[model samples]
Structure formats: structure tokens, C-alpha cells
Target: MLIGVPKEIKTHEYRVGMTPASVREAVHHGHEVLVETGAGAGIGAHDDAYRAAGARIARDAAEVFANAEMIVKVKEPQANERAMLREGQILFTYLHLAPDPDQTRDLLKAGVVAIAYETVTAPDGSLPLLAPMSQVAGRMSVQAAAHCLEKEQGGMGILPGGVPGVKPARFCIIGGGVVGENAAAMAIGLGADVVIIEKSVPRMQQLHRIFGHAVNTVYSTRLTIEEEVLAADVVICGVLIPGAAAPKLISRDMVRRMKPGSVIVDVAIDQGGCAETSMPTTHAEPTYVVDDVVHYCVANMPGAVARTSTYALNNATLPHILAIADKGWRQALAEDEHLLHGLNVAYGHITHEAVARSLNMPWTDPHTFVRD
Candidate 1:
């Protein structure tokens, strides 16, 4: 099998799909790996490193995409890249198709096998490939929120952790999954009054145990979310529904209710965002003010720290990439139920239920295609 890794072209997305170590693994398994030149440079990995690991360096993305059977990428194919996709090419990446009708249509038109990392679920119902990046985005949410809270950034001029005799900022985190947990940890560490709104009772209980007095766990409700969000100096939107679009928990009207100069970091923006005002922003211009509330919705938050994100993502995705490369998608999906769930679109058919429902497309059961 020939695998390709292209440099991320999204604005401020510096993370590459495959690291040098990941390339070495593929090479060891007798699979040819092609990495586009400077693909790993943003992640502090040079072409020489990939070459040292037995990967062939292509001068351009076209060469890498044109030659490989499977293209492993950090982000979904942008408009330009999607145009180059050919029939039967396997695109394994974070394809958040639920929110983007254009991208979904393009994938079907191209007839490529689109395996989404976020949809891949383990037996324990955990997204292995999405977890590492989610953790990174969750942590970055706080940093972004903090930065936006500075007076110069048009925030309330409140410090996250207030000094003696000063009140600490209030942070409200929506959801209690990986993103929420990490956000809570960061907010609490900064001495802010952290409140987590979670729908799952058991998860809330676990959060109560883990955080004790450091964080407050609330049973999420319309009133609760509205009240807490309005009171928060910084609100982190981290709600996720696997392959589906994130629920719009915060309404446009609600944005007007929040205090002026409040900061909102919608970590769920990749899935269309939980905040009604959330529009995909780039790191070049990461924030926009709506109703005097600053919204930081950089879709690829983890990409800002490419080196850390690359190594962290490789740690989780390499094993699955190797499995797919060695066994082939059919064999790999047939053998691993977890990997099978990741298959979103294959041969112009939507295999993931959530993606199909979200996009109003016909759904095909994954089991029918990957039956052992």
C-alpha cells in the first residue's frame, strides 16, 4: 500500500498528518510512504527526518496525492485539495462532514473512501483518534479565552486568576467529555471559578469526585446553561455528538444577554459549534465581536502548537494507520469494529448514520460493506 501525508493548508493549521516515527512504522511494515516536502516542518520535523525514516519526499501536494492509495491528513480536504481527489482514493482524516454540505457532496462526487477520525469509536465508545486532538483543543480553549479576556482584546479586563482582594474570573464549560474535562482542569488550575454543565448524571458524579471543590458540576438544562453562560467571564463550548453537528446550545439572542467584553471560545466549532454566534475563524484573525462578546472559534485550535499536536496525534493514530495499511480498509474494518465505525463515505455512499442524517443523504449500514 502507498500512503501519503500532505501538509495542512488550512490557515494557521501547522500540524502534519504523519510524523517521522509514523513513517518509519509504515516503512517497517513494507508499505511505501510519501510525504510532501515541508509537510512536517511546522511540527518541527524536516523532510530529512522523513527521508531518514525511509519515506520518499514529494515536491508538491499534487505528487503526493496523485501517487498514494491512501492520504492521511490532519484536516479534511480543503476546496482546492478536494478538487484533486480521484475515484477510489482513501482519505483518512478528521472529516467533520456533518456541518459542511459542500465538502460532503465533493467527497461523494470524488468517490473516495472518507474515513473520519471523530466517528471512529472503540468498544468502550471512545474516539481514539479524536481524543488526543480533543484534549489539545480543550486545553487551548482556556488559553484562547484567557488571551481574549485581556483589555486590549476588548475583554472585561479581568484576570483568570485574580490577585489578593480581587475576584477571580468565572468560567463556564459546556459538556463534560474529554474537551470539557480538560477545559475544567485548565480553568481550575488558573484559580477561576469553574462550572461544568453535563447531561450525563454518572459523568457529572465522576467529575464531582475528580474535581471536588475545584470545579462545580451542574446538571445541564436550558435555564442552567443560560444563567451560567450569562454570568461567566469566559465560556468554553466543547459539546460534541461524535460524527453529528454539535447542538446549538447557545442562541444568538443569548449572546446579547452575556456581559459586554465576555469571551467565548467555541472548541466545538469544527462540528458547527454549540454557540449560535460561532463562525469558523482562522488564527490569522481568530476573534470576532458579536453583541460586544468576543468569539474565538479557531476551528483548528490544536494546529497552533503543531509539534506537540503532531507527536500527540501520532501516538494515537499510528496504530490504526498501520492496521489499515497492512490489512486494507475492507479487511481492517471487518476485523476491527472500532475502525469500521470510522467509515463515513465509501464509493459515493454514506456509511455513517450521523453524517447521513446530518447531511440529508441516503445511509448505508457499515456492516453491509465490511461484513467479515
Candidate 2:
């Protein structure tokens, strides 16, 4: 098997699919690795490093895409990259397809076997592949919000942790999952008053035990979200629905009611966001003002810290990559139920139920084609 790594071409997406260490492991497993020239530049690994790791560097993405049996990428294929996909070729990457109809259509047209990292699940129902970036983005959300809260950035000039005699800023996190938990830790560590609104009683109780008197855990509801969001200085929306689009818990009216110059960082923007006003933004211009409230909705917040994100992601994805390379995708999926959940589209058909339902497309069970 030949695994190809192409440089990410998304707006300000600087992470690469495979690190030299990942390539070396694949090489050790007797798989050939092809990396497009400068693919690892974002993470500061040059061609020489990949070459030293037994990877051949292609002159361009076209050559790599044309030759490799499996394309390993950090982000989903862009329009041009999607056009180059061949039938039966494997695309193992983060395909946030529930919100992106065009990408789903393109994958179907290309007849490629698309395996999304974000959709893979662990035995305990945790998202193992998506956890590293969730941690990265969750930590970054507060940093972004703190910057957005500066007066020059259209915020209320409120510091996240106030000085002596001044009250600290209030932060409302809309989920208690990995993203919300990491955000709460960061916010609380910075001396900000934090409240986490979650629906799960067990999870909320765990959060209560984790934070004790430091953080407030409230049962999530329409009234609670509205009240908490309106009163908060910064609201971090970290809600997720696996491979489906994120539920819009914060309405436009709720945004309108928030205090003037407050910040809302929709960390769920990758899954189409949890706010009605949330639109994908880039690190170049990461914020927009609506109803006089600051909204930071960068779709790839982890991408801004490419080196850290790339290493963390490769750590989680390498074993799966090795599995696909050594056993082939069919055998790999057949052997690992968790990996089979990653299959979204294969041979012009949608294979993931959540993605199919979200896009209003028919889905064939992945197991049916695993033996085909």
C-alpha cells in the first residue's frame, strides 16, 4: 500500500496529514509513503526529514494523488483536490460533511472511499480522533475570546480576570464534553467565573465534582441558555452531535439580547455551529460584530497552531493509518468496528447514517460493502 500526504490548502489550514514520525512508522510496517513537496512545512518538517523517514517527495499534489492508493490528509479535500480523486481510492481525513453539501456531492461523484477521522468512535462512545483537536480548539477559544473582548477588537474592554476590587468576567460554556471541559479548565485557571450548561445529569455531576465551588453546572434548557448567555461576558458554544450538524441552541434573538460588546466563540463552527448567526470565519479575519456583540467563529481554530495540532493529531491517527495501510481499508474496517464508523462515502454511496440523514441522501450500511 502507498500512503500519500498532501499539504493542506484550506484557508489558513497549515496542518499536514502525516508527520515524518508517522511516515517512519508506516515505512516500518512495509508501506510506501509519498509526501508532496513541502507538505510538512507547516509543522516545520522539510523534504529532507520526510526523505530521511523513507518517504519519497513528489513534486506536486497531482503526482502524489495520481499514484498513491490512499490519500492521508489533515483537512478535507478542496475543490481541486477532490477533482483529482479516483474511484476506489481511500481518503482518510476530517470530512465535516454534515454541513458541507458540496463536498459530499463531490466525494460521491469521485467514487472515492471517504473515511472521516471525526466520525470514528471508541468503545466508550468517545471520539478518539477528534479529541486532540477538540482539546486544542477548546483551549484556544478562551484566548480568542479574551482578545476579542479588548476594546480595540469591538469588545467591552473587560479583562477575563479582573484586577483588585474589580469583578472577573463571566463565561458560559454550552457543553460539558471534551471541548467544554477543556475550556472550563482554561477559563477557571485564568480566574474567570465559569458556568457550564449541560444536559446529561451524570456528566453534569462529574463536572460538579471536578470543579466543586470553582464552576457552576446548570441543567441546559431554552430558558437557562438564554439567561446565562445574555448575562455572560463571554459565551463558548462547544456543543457537538457526532457526524450531524450542531444544534442551534443560541438563536439570533439570543445574540441580540446579549450585552453590548460581549464575545461569543462558537467552537462548534466546524459542525455548522450552535448559533444562528455563526458563519465560518478564517484566522485572517476571525471575528464579526452583529447586534453590537463580538462573534468569533473560526472554523479551524486548531489550524492556527499548526505544529502542536499536527503532532497531537498524528499521535491519535497514526495507529489507524497503519491499520489501513497494512490490512487494507476493507480488512481494517471489517476488523475494527470503531474504524468502520469512520466510513462516510464509498464507491459513490454514503455509508454513514448521520451524514446521509443530514444531507438527505440514502445510505448503505458500511458492513454491507466491507465484504464486497
Candidate 3:
């Protein structure tokens, strides 16, 4: 099997699909690795490093896409990259197809076998591939909010951890999953008053046991969401519905009533956002003022720390990538039901039910493609 690693081309996305270490592993597995020239520049890895790792460096994406059986990428294929895709080529990446109709259309037209990292599941029903970046994004959300809290950034000019005479800023985190838990950890570390709104009773109890008096846990309700978001200085929206679009828990009217210059970091922006007013922003211009509320909705927050994100993401994705390379996608996916869940589109058909439903497209069962 020949695998291609392309440099990510999304707006402000600096993470590459495979590191030199990953290439070395693939080579050791009897798979040929082709990396685009300067593919690892974002993570400070040079083409020579890939060469040293037994990877052949290609001059451009066209060569990589044309020759490799599987294309490994950090982000979804851009328009140019999508145009380069060929029939039956495997695209293993984070394709958030729910909110992007253009991308969904292009992948279907290309007849590519697309596997979405976020849709892959573990034995425990956790999203293993998505967890690394979620952990990064969840922790980064607090850092972004902290910066947004300053007056110059359109925030309330309050400090997250206030001085001796002033009170610390308050934080309201929606959802108590991976993102919300990490956000609470960061906010609490800074001595900020933190409240996590969760719907799961067992998870809420777990959080209470973990943080005790350091953080407040609340049951999620329309009334609690309204009251808590309106009162908090920083509101982090981290709710997610997996391969489906994120639910809009915070309405535009709700945002309009937030304190003047308050901040919102919508960590769920990748799956669309939990706020009605939430729109994707970029790292170049990460924030915008909305009804006197500051919104930080960068779709790829982990890209801001490319090195850490790349390594962490590679750790989670490498095993799955190797499986596809060693045994072919069909055999590997047929063997592992969890991996089958990652197959969103194949042979000009939508394989993932959630993604097809989200896009209002005809659904094709994934098993049809997995011939044992």
C-alpha cells in the first residue's frame, strides 16, 4: 500500500496529516509513504526529515494524490485538493460534512471512499480520534476567552483571576463532556468561578466528585441555560451531537441579553455551533462583536498549536491508518465495526446515516462497501 501525506490547506490550519515518526512506522509496516514537499513545515518538520524516515517527498499535491492509494490529511480537502481526488481513492481525515454542503457534494461527485475521524468510535462509545483535538480545543477555549476578556478585545475589561480587591470573572460551560471538562479545568486553575451545565446525572456526579468545591455543577435546563449564560462573564459552548450538527442551545435573543462585552468561546464550532449566532471564524480574525457579546468561533482552534495537535492527533489516528494500509480499507473496516462507523461516503454514496440525514441525501449502507 502507498500512503500520501498532504499539507493541510484550510484557513489557518497548520497541522499536517502524518509526522515523520508516523511515516517511519508506515515504512516499518511494509507500506510506502509519500509526503508532499514541506508538508510538515507547520510542525517544524522538514522534507529531509521525512526522507530520513523512509518517505519519498513529492514535489506537489497532484503527484501525491495521483499516486498514493490512501490520502491522509489533517483537515478536509479544499476545492483544489478535492478536484485532485480520483475514484476509489481513500481519504482519511476530519471531514465535518454536516455543515458544509459544498464539501459533501464534491466528495460524492469524486466517488472517493471518505472516512471521517470524528465519526470513528471506541469500544466504550467514545470518539477516540476526535478526542485529541477536542482536548486541545477545550483547553484552548479558556485561553482564548481569557484574552477576549480584556477591554481591547471587546470584552468587559475584567480579569479572569481578579486582583486582591476585585472579584474573579465567572465562567459558564455548556456540556460536561471532554471539552467542557477541560474548559472547567483551565478556568478553575485560573481561580475563576466556574459552573458546568450538564444533562447526564452520572457525569455530573463524577464531576462533583472530581472538583468538589472548586467548581459548580448544574443540571441543564432552558431556564438554567438562560440564567447562567446571561450572568457569566465567559460562556463556553461545548455541546456536541457527534456526526450531526451541534444543537443551538443559545439563541440569538439569548446572546443579545448577555452582559455588554461578555465573551463566548464556541468549542462546538467544528460541528457547527451551539449558538444561533455562531459562525465560523479563522485564527487570522478569531473574534467578532455580536450584540455587544464577543464570539470566538474559530473552526480549527487546535491548529493554533500545530505541533502539539499534530502529535496528539497522529497518536490516535496512526493505528487506524496502518490498518487500512495493511489490509485494505474494506477488509479492515469489515473486521472492526468501530472503523466501519468512520466510513461516511464511498462509491458515490453516503455511508454514514447521520451525515446523509444531516445533508438530506440518499443513504447507502456502509456494509455494502465492506466485502469480506
lDDT of 3 by residue, 1-372 (tens): 999998788888889999999999999999999999989999999999999999999999999999999999989899999999999999999999999989999999999999999999999999999999989999999999999999999999998988898999999999999999999999999989999999999999999998999989999999999999999999999998878989899999999999999999999988889999999999999999999999999999999999999999999999999999999999999999999999999989999999888889899999998875
Candidate 1 segments exceeding 4 Å error: none
Q: Write the per-residue lDDT of candidate 1 for residues 1-372, one digit (tens) a residue.
A: 999999999998899999999999999999999999999999789999999999999999999889999999999999999999998898999999999999999999999988988999988998989999989999999999999999999999999999999999999999999999999999889999999999999999999999998998889999999999999999999999988999999999999999999999999999999998999999999999999999999999998998999899889889989999999989999998899899999988999999899888899998887775
Weakest lDDT window of 10 consecutive positions for candidate 1: 363-372
lDDT of 2 by residue, 119-234 (tens): 99999999999999999999999999999999999999999999899999999999999999999999998999999999999999999899899999999999999999999999
Q: Give each model a TM-score.
A: 0.99, 0.99, 0.99
Clashing pairs in 1: none
User: RMSD to native for every prediction?
Assistant: 0.8, 0.8, 0.8
Report the lDDT of model 1 for residue 152: 98
